[model samples]
Target: MNEENTFETHRPRLFGLSYRLLGSRSDAEDVVQDAWLRWQQADHASIRDPEAWLVTAATRLGIDRLRAARVQRGRYVGPWLPEPAEIDEAPGPDHHAERAEQVSLAFLAVLERLGPEERAAYLLKEAFDYEYAQIAPLLGQSEANCRQMVHRARERVQAARPRFEVEPERHRKLLERFMHAASRGDQTAITALLREDARLVSDGGGKALAVIRPLLGRERIARLFWAAYRRRDPAIEWRMGMVNGEPAILRYRTGKLAAVMVATTDGERIVELLNVANPDKLGAGVTPDPGRASW
Candidate 1:
């Protein structure tokens, strides 16, 4: 039997893989849909390994889209930001859902800094448990080169590992402090929360407003947040939402999201701040929820 339901069983893996590659919920959904479409078009009676085929198909689809995505992004208006990846890790989440959410958000976000091939290499080798030899043909690289790439990427990511892993509750508290600090212009509180070497990056995509360079230093970033909030309409609303499987704030003005901030906390302080203000990269047709904060 072709087993029509077989694909449904693998949907979680496919979704997690796609979301990690593209950093967008909608894009991941699209990638999985395209993979299923390929299955539908295949002759399928003798397909040897459906799981391998689906993974390969979805990975390549994401890469194809990513190439075009990069080109179009160069002409983007104010700042270019990755789409906020939201995941559900509430206490009652399904096992697959919780695991997939963590993989898609925190772990995947770390891969974003690498080149597409490096990112793919690291994800497949580390997360999906693919050996370098198996990963070689995916990018047309030799096994040895693939091994080297994975090795290099791992070193870089490992070097930046924080003092602790962020669980859901702790992650929420970190975001709360950050939003509160930013809202109240509390430099003292902000300093205690942000790492000494913490960096803040924002992508406005030119269509919206944001800071271009990674803001460094306590005073500079402190002023940065203070000014941003001061300029925001007092009536503007802020809601805490799950982004990248961690707690994040989605700032809205009127009905549109002005910013989506993701926080990565170290043992004692937040280490990285990625604020997305790019309208085009806000994950396709999904509307910014006015009631988003309740999450």
Candidate 2:
């Protein structure tokens, strides 16, 4: 196969690696585009493994972007959350249970706590199934050091991992009930669906109106949601769908995408709620008119 075709074959994998590393679709796309440019300029005849080379290049670029992103996020106006990306349910080589879990907002949130190198090491080893020996050269670190980084990253991630696994159907049911209560401004019903220590964070990117800080405790969160829906435009609509392998609610205002909401549950109740209202981050699967009433 020619170099262009070979690069096209591995584009999805490269984008996946970059997206997981940076947690931003725009940055991932830039990284993959830059990798393609590098691939074109290099002497492909001398390279033994094109896929590995492309992956390494994309990963390094993602790491660099992530490092710079941390500084920008620090100055962000409100609580920062990863942009929600729509998941394709079609049967594909990359569609699997493990990949779904790794791409989840809950998982990515935990990854954000780790340093850039640690995040890279963990994703390469756990998500992509890369060996320490293989990852060492990419990170320019000793195999032993890569192992240590993965170990540390794993421990930190495990510490914050979900306490219980809710079946997909049950999770959707719980979210629906929570949304129903919020839509009706039922504080009692909403509070019943939230864990006592539940937290709600909204990301408006300073362009939209949202909570400046995270709302803690079930009562406070319930009240916030109740008040929020009460103030929303009555013409707006809510649609339930999957985002990042989990159930989510998409809000539409005048047939335009307004916000995306995803929650992390502890089997019976929601422990965390993430509301993404940032216009810049609402690109995936969102159109001027979604057409359907609901998913």
Candidate 3:
């Protein structure tokens, strides 16, 4: 295959790497596009490994974008969420379960605590299965330094990662019950399904109405959901689907997508709820219309 075809072959992995590092589909796309441009301009004849060259280029671009994004996110209103994306269930034979889990909102949230280089090193080693030797030059560090970055990032991510259910069916059932309870303003039932320390976070990007800070406690979360549904337009609809490899509730207002919600549970009860209401972030993974759905 030619250079264009070769780049096309690696686009998915390139996008995946950038997305995991940056946690924003648009930003990831920008990084991948930038990598493609660089690839076009580079003398491919001298490159022994096109994939490695592309991976290094994309990884560096992601690190720079993420650094800039951290600054902007600091000024963002409310909790910032990774833009949710529709996962392709069959992403070819190269897809790894570990990589799939890394795309989760819960996992991505943990990654936010990591610095740019640390995040890239950790992902390259863990998610992409790159060796320390391979990851060293990718981040412009020594192999030992890359290993240290991955080690530090791993500790932080593991400590902060929420314990979400691994079974998809059980997760879906739990969400269904929560949705049913919230739809009817059944705060008692809602509270019953939550862990005592359950937290609700929304990303409104200051463009939509959302809780400025994380709402904690089962009681508070229950009440917030109860009040939120009660105040919403009667015509708005809830559609259940999978997002970022987990079950999600997609809200629609007048047939337009409004928000996407996904909960992280410990099999028995939900420990965290993430709602993304930012319009700009909604365009990536979710379908605009998923037909009518009910709890």
Encode model 3's per-residue lDDT on 1-295: one tens digit a residue: 8989999999999999999999899999999999999999999999999999999999988988998999999899888999876733223334333326788877788899999999999999999999988988777899989988888998888788745545777777899798888877789999999999998999999898899999999999888878977886787777666678667777777766778888888889998898889999876665433233521
Query: Per-residue alpha-carbon lDDT of model 1 for 1-295, expressed as tens digits?
Result: 4456989988889888777777766778898999999989886777788888888888888887766766776676644555655522232333221324335334555666667788778888877999877788877899999989899988877775443655657667778878888888777888878878887878886667677777886667888777766776776777666555456777767755566787667646787787877765664534334434542
Clashing pairs in 1: 77-206, 78-205, 78-206, 79-205, 79-206, 85-244, 239-293
Candidates in order, TM-scores: namely 0.81, 0.92, 0.92
lDDT for each residue of candidate 2 in 114-167, tens digit (9 for 90 to 100): 999899999999999999989999999999999999999999998977556677
- lDDT for every model? 0.71, 0.83, 0.83
Clashing pairs in 3: 86-285
Clashes of each: 7, 0, 1
lDDT of 2: 0.83
How far is 219's C-alpha from truth in model 3 (Å)? Answer: 0.3
- Order of all candidates by lDDT, from best down to worst? 3, 2, 1
Given candidate 2, what's the lDDT at residue 167? 77
